[model samples]
Target: MSVLAAIAITTGILSGVWGWVAVSLGLLSWAGFLGCTSYFASPKDGLKGLGLSIATNLSGVFWAMVIIHLSTWVGIDIVGYVVTAVVAFFMCIQAKHNILNYIPGTFIGSCATFAAAGDWQLVVPSLLLGGVFGFAMKASGVWLQETLNKPDTELCEEN
Candidate 1:
């Protein structure tokens, strides 16, 4: 979780340095806020907190979509939704223990962005990313399971 926060911050700083200053700053700020709130939460609670945090972030997407709709970027609203969906799907695959717990946030984000952009372009890419994430999780889970199933004797070999 802390690593996620660090990644977000790093990405934001990189984006800012690359000229998307306002957007980067906003994202970084939101990540910081959520990271602080999640600092003391348990793993289960942390997943729930992430959902809540994403729900809040969706508000920004809503407003950004409104602004985009009023301006020249008329069909860009779905971009944010697609990005979030892809991330969420991967997150669920990686952490299936409480994956379904975030459905509410995913639904809310997808609905909001879809409504704003009215485009289907987001679906295919999101699904592709989801599949990739699922595969990765499957591989990792198998590895972990095998490791855990090792015989006690193998683990207790003379040092």
Candidate 2:
């Protein structure tokens, strides 16, 4: 199995064992983000993709909070429209530079955040852990690719 898949499966098992649904969702969302970025964006643009994923996740959470606050002042229906527009506008602006390619990943992260009831204490740690896992997964993929591509002599030679 691929390293990424193995990591995800391990994370899933551990999260399920600990009954940490939020962490599980966060990790899954991050894995999705990494996969999307890796597939859609160039390998050399990994950092850019990572930054955009982070921005999108942060914006999703921020917008969710805004919508919640506005719902109290206005109404859920109106607030929904406003929030949608705001998110769309921001996403469009970001997309202009092709940096927002991981939009699905952002939405996944947002869903994970909302699923955790927008609790900062819970969400922050979960997302951070997910990010770390995502990075490790990506790095593992890179390492595996490099190893596979190396000549047999390189593999057999002593360091």
Candidate 3:
């Protein structure tokens, strides 16, 4: 419960900071938040979580781009649907790779890109920065929890 509290506090503060930075820089806070949420879903935490979130998430961006281009190029409704389906298959199957195993991150990345109307330029940097924010959020939370100090459980004596 203490750990959960730590995470909640960190999430609230960082979310505010992230929104501020986004508004200041005219970036999409929601998009960056999407990436941040993806971090918790990552296979590991610390540097590994950061790296995996970025990698798997970017692959999603790439596949989404492929879906957009190929579908547009084909110039048919059915073809577009097929292209999306095919790309989706690839996206899911990519979990076969050890490093690219976080499927939700990929989905989140793709959704972010699509929400941005495929502006990877804007989304890329935002998502990348999001990974950093996510790392900081967790690190600070864990640190705060440790600093505050707490017992995980207590034993009771029977009278």
Which candidate wins on lDDT? 3
Order by TM-score, highest first: 3, 2, 1
Residue-wise C-alpha lDDT for candidate 2, range 7-54, written one tens digit per residue: 455555544443354445543444343333333333233556556666
Report the lDDT tens digits of candidate 1 across residue range 26-63.
32322332222322231333335544434433433443
* Runs with alpha carbons beyond 4 Å of true place in candidate 1: 1-116, 152-159
lDDT of each: 0.39, 0.54, 0.87
Instruction: Evaluate model 1: give its lDDT.
Output: 0.39
Off by over 4 Å in 3: 150-159
**lDDT per residue as tens, model 3, 37-134:** 88877879888998889998899899989988998898999999999999999999999997889998898889888999999989988888777888
- Output the lDDT of residue 74, model 2: 72
Comparing 2 with 3 on TM-score, the higher-scoring candidate is: 3
- Report the CA-based lDDT of candidate 2 relative to the real structure: 0.54
lDDT for residue 86 in candidate 1, whole number 0-100? 58
